[model samples]
Target: MDFQLSEQHEMLRKAIREFAEKEIAPLVEKMEETGEFPLEIRQKMGAVGLCGLVTSPEYGGNGMGFLARAIGIEEVSRVCAGLGIALQVHHMCCWPLETWGTEEQKKKYLPRLASGETFGVCSITEPSGGSDPMGMQTEARLEGDYWIVNGRKCFATNSHVSDIMIIVAKTGTDPKGRPAFSAFIVEPDFEGFSLGREEKKMGFKGASSGELVFNDCKVPKENLLGKEGEGLKIALATVNRVGRPGMASIGVGICYASLEEASKFAKERVLGGKPIANLQAIQFMLADMFALAEAARILNYRANWMMDQGMNCDTEMTLAKYVATENAFQCARLACEIHGGYSCISEYAVQRFLRDAWVAIPSGGTSQIAKIVLGRHVTKNF
Candidate 1:
């Protein structure tokens, strides 16, 4: 198997990394201080085709597929994981609209989404719980030409800033009396729909994560994303196929950041009249960090490659997400240790890396959920 990245991929990586260092790095301090998502920066990323990587060429996208998407996210994340995850979740909204949207819907929304004319979100979580879809309290009822939706969604990414949001709401009951759900596209002009409290997260400070409130919201029937009762299927596919891989990419980026910072500090910092790089303990710690970073890269890249090839890789992607995110947290801690007292300071990037690493753990799916998926897959097939 080939281990090296293609020329094109390498070029894309370098370009994104350079862009992050030059363009995004300058804004990190301000963004973190205020906890704001940089809409202008997102638009710039769209101008460069980063926002439209997986979108079709017919809609002005580059059609670069998941590997390119992962690479872009990873490179950006290496400099600033908040922006990396924000970009990743931004693609989450685009994925479903492209894969499941009707021609009319795609025509109307994909172009704008691709151009970053407005941001998008897939709102699924509720106060009830996200992992358990059946427990969701959000419900919608069919009216004349519109559906009246009433619910509250919390911990939704881009809730306050998104212009286009696809929301999942219970529409009916199944044969067993379980709630049947459907997905709908909610526009900014939708009546009775408004942004709720914006959550101040511990990490990813610049990336918006908050609540969406829909009270007697009027949504036209045409806004239904797929066939009725298909919301669960679409939500599952989108989260597994698109969200998890993007999250894995974020983890890989954080891993890279950890190793890079640790290595740089070890080489430069002097201790006992010599550089810390000469110490066996420091060397072993750096070696471990390096290994974890490499492993994260391999797992995340391979999972994204499988997605690009149109292979069924949910389990593979789950494993990648679980391992990469967990290792990223661990690696960030190690990097902080290598940095000594300075790592705890907000001025150092290592502290930020550690914060971002913790946030990634449960973003796509919890590491516990990932293991359950793997366990089920092994038991069912083996």
Candidate 2:
């Protein structure tokens, strides 16, 4: 694989970096203080093409593909991971729709999503179903011209801000007693659909992480995504491609941030009348941080590049998510240690990076789960 990024990608990176530094940086202080993201930022992102990366131009989307999307996410994340996460989740909401929705569904929703007229969310996690698809308690029953959906979806990002949602619920039991699932393009105006208690998370604070409550929510029959009993398939594919790559992008951004923070501190911080950069210990730490950051980036970029090439890289994406997130955590912790007592204080950005790193592990599915998938791949292939 060519290690060099295309001129288009480089230019894209420069554009995003400039936008994030100019627009997003000014808002980070407020978002960190209030845990409330500005809706205006989403609008601005759409204007800059961040919101339409995954979409086709036929539907008012840029259709740039995954690698470009990852770069955009990573650059945005380098300044504020929370906003980056919100953008990524918005793309996640777009993925199944474009991949599975009817042309009419595309025409109706894609333009709205592409333009950031409203945020889009994919809500599937439930109190009963942490990782197991069959454990989903959200049930949908087909009625005349609609489906009645009833249950709570937890940890749904953009819960408050989103007007469009890709909702997954169990529709029936299969012949083998497995819970069959279906996906829907639900709107906030749908009857019985409401926002539940918002979660006060330790990280990704301003992403509006919360619950999606559907109490006999009525969705039109035409809004169903893909074939019947394909919700699990849709969910899995989205998670494998859009979800995991997003996590990796955030991880890579954090890793790079950690490296920058650590390198700067080591160079400027004084110990025994000399800058800590004079010490071999500090040098080694910086070296490791740099190496790991680059490694994570290479892994994540390779996975997304493979995806853009139309290859099924489930195992590769899983590994990239695992390594990138875990390395991010480790690197952030090291950066924190380099900050010494200063790291514990809220004033330091490294502390925030550490918190966000921990949250990243569980966002796209936990690191433990990634290991299981990778372990299975190892056993099956090796």
The numbered model that scores best in lDDT is 2
Q: Which pairs clash inside model 1?
A: none
Q: Give the CA lDDT, 0 to 100, for residue 378 in model 2.
A: 91
Candidate 1: worst 10 consecutive residues by lDDT? 111-120
Residue pairs with backbone atoms closer than 3 Å in model 2 (clashes): none
Off by over 4 Å in 1: none
TM-score per model over all chains: 0.98, 0.98
Candidate 2 lDDT over 1-382, as tens digits, reads 4799999999999999999999998988788889997999878898899999999999888999899999999999888999988999999999889999999999999998999888899878898755776788999999999999999999998999999999889999888988899999999999999999888889887879889999999999999999889999999999899999999999999999899988888888999999998899878888888888999999999999999999989988998899999989989998998889989999889999999999999988898889999999999999
lDDT of 1 by residue, 1-382 (tens): 8878889889899888888898899989987899998878878888877889989989867888898998999988888888888788878889898988999998898888888777789878898888888888899999999999999999888777788899899999888887899999999689989889999989988988998899999999999999889998888888898888888999999998999999999999999999999999999999998899889889888988989888989988998899899989999999999999999889889999999999999998789889999999999999
Q: Which stretches of candidate 2 lie over 4 Å from their true place?
A: none
For all candidates, what are the clash counts?
0, 0
Q: Which ten residues in a row have the lowest lDDT in candidate 2?
A: 127-136
